[model samples]
Structure formats: structure tokens, C-alpha cells
Target: MKKITTPLKEKDIRALKAGEEVLLKGVIYTARDQAHKRLCDLIKKRRQLPFALKNQIIYYCGPTPAPPGKIIGSCGPTTSSRMDKFTIPLLKNGLKGMIGKGKRSAEIISAIKKYKAIYFLAPAGAGAYLSKFVKKKELISWPELGTEAIFRLEVEDFPLIVGIDIKGRSIYDKR
Candidate 1:
């Protein structure tokens, strides 16, 4: 498996292929459905975002509250397709990568190729297990939205698979 860090570089993204295993490290931002909508809305109005999208990776997740002494809790990936409508706008704005579960639409695949981006698949039903990789968590925005709020997480060697590569290749396409 290839080991990679955050704010993914073009060389790193291009070297990856669909179905390849990866260990991702560094910072990733969490943004669920609500956060996505908010971000897209901001893009529409040409307003400044809470964070810049350039070369950034957004994980589709809404982590549960941390218990006793953990950095995070049940931090699993959400379905990627739900954000399909909001995705292209972010990609257009320079978002480079995404981590989530399940397949993406054909248009999204086409867009991924056009924008030179990649999509990663995290383990499903492994929320509790995945929490072990999160080293730190800081609220980024919309705390009132609770779990759906945006969060910045520092991770180390978090496991993932390339669900869709920059060439528009997809593991789901095999079926």
C-alpha cells in the first residue's frame, strides 16, 4: 500500500490507480450533508469558505462525540453519492480528493477525470476501529449543527482504497 499525506499533490493523485490500497496520513476535513450544502451555497454566492478547497481532501463523515479520553468517536465514512450534487462545485473550486463509502455517479466519475481528482473508500462498519487512527480533532465550523458540523482531524496511517482514480476508473465499474 502506498502511504500518502494531506493536501494531496498531483503527482501522488496521478500515481494512484483504482483498487489500490493506501495509508493516508495528515489532516483531513470532515463534512457531512449539511456541511456540504453550506459549502456549496457559499460557492454559489462567491463568498469565502470557512476553509480553502485547494488541494484539500474532504471526508464524508459526521463523527459521533468523543467519549472519556478519545480524540474522536465512531468516525466512519458516509455514502459518497449523497454529495454528488455538491461535488462538482467544490472540484471546480480546487478540491482535490475525497474519502467516503460506496460508489459515485457516472457524472462524478467524469468530473473526477476532468478535474484530476481521486476518491477513496474507507472501511464500512469500522467506525469504532477507525477512531483509533484519529490523533486530533478540532471543530472547524457550524458547531450548532452538531455531528454534521465540519471538523479538522489529524490522522496517521488511516487505511483506505482508491474507489475512483484520476483517470475515471472505479472499483464499482467492475460489477
Candidate 2:
């Protein structure tokens, strides 16, 4: 098992072997389907995105709204396969990491290897528990997309397991 700390370094991710478990800490961005589409369009036209992509982590989820006095609502990993199509292009633009649940497509796996990126899996069906780790949330873009809006989440000691590595290896498939 490996430990992945915040301001996540590519060396740590690249050193991770297939089937290794990892605990991740630090901030991660949130983007759902609609936001992803808009991001792709922005990338295509060479427009600036709300956040810089370098050395960042993008979590694929659309969390429930927070209740009073809470930093965030039920936060959990969404299915990752939905974001597969957007993965390659985003990776090309400096996206180094992803967090989500379930398997991604072949093309995405290929992109990960090409881009030297990593994918982590957060616990599924544990939204409320995960919400505790989020300290704050900022809507970054595509607010008109409703829950599908992109959010920049500030987290601390966010739990995670290494799902896929830059070498096109996956933990889930080995199991």
C-alpha cells in the first residue's frame, strides 16, 4: 500500500503498483457530466477554465446540497464511466488525477497511461460519511448546469484507494 498526501505529487502516483491501496489528502475539484461537456468545449476553443489543471485532482460527482451549518452535503463518488469520453482531452490539458467510483472505459485507461495520470476510488454509497471530510465548496463554473456545475472542493485527509495507475493497470480488474 502507498500513501498519497495532498498537493499530490506525480512521483507518488507513478510509484503506486497495481492493487496497492492509498489514502489521499488535499483539495479536489468536482465536475459532473454537464460541466465536463462545457469544459471540453472550452478546451476545444482554447478558452480559460475556472481552475488551473496543473497537478490537480478532479472528482466525478454531483453532491447533495448541504444542510444548515454544514460545509458540504452528502458527498460521494459517482460512477466514473460517464466521464470516460472527456478524460483523454482533459488529461492532455494537464489533468493529472481523478477520483470516482466504478470502472472507466478503455479509452480513458489508455489516456491515463499516455498522460501519466492516476485514478482513485472513493467509497461508494457513503455520501454522508464522506461529507465530513469536505471543509468548503466553491462553485467554479457552469452554474447554470444545476447540480452538474463544477465545484472546487477543499478537503482534508480525504480517504481513497488507488483504482487505476498510469501504466494502464487497475485494482478492480485484478480482484
lDDT of each model, Cα atoms only? 0.95, 0.84
lDDT at residue 130 of model 2 (Cα atoms): 90
Which pairs of residues have clashing backbones in candidate 1? none
Ten contiguous residues with the weakest lDDT in model 2:
1-10
> What are the per-residue Cα lDDT tens digits for candidate 2 across 13-130?
7788655666666778899788888889999999998888987899998999888899888889899998888888899988899999999888888888988899988999999999
TM-score of each: 0.99, 0.93
Supply candidate 1's per-residue lDDT for 175. Answer: 95
Model 1, clash count?
Answer: 0
* Global CA lDDT computed for model 1: 0.95
Write model 1 residue lDDT over 79-174, tens digit each, in one string: 999999999999999999999999999999999999999999999879999999999999999999999999999999999999999999999887
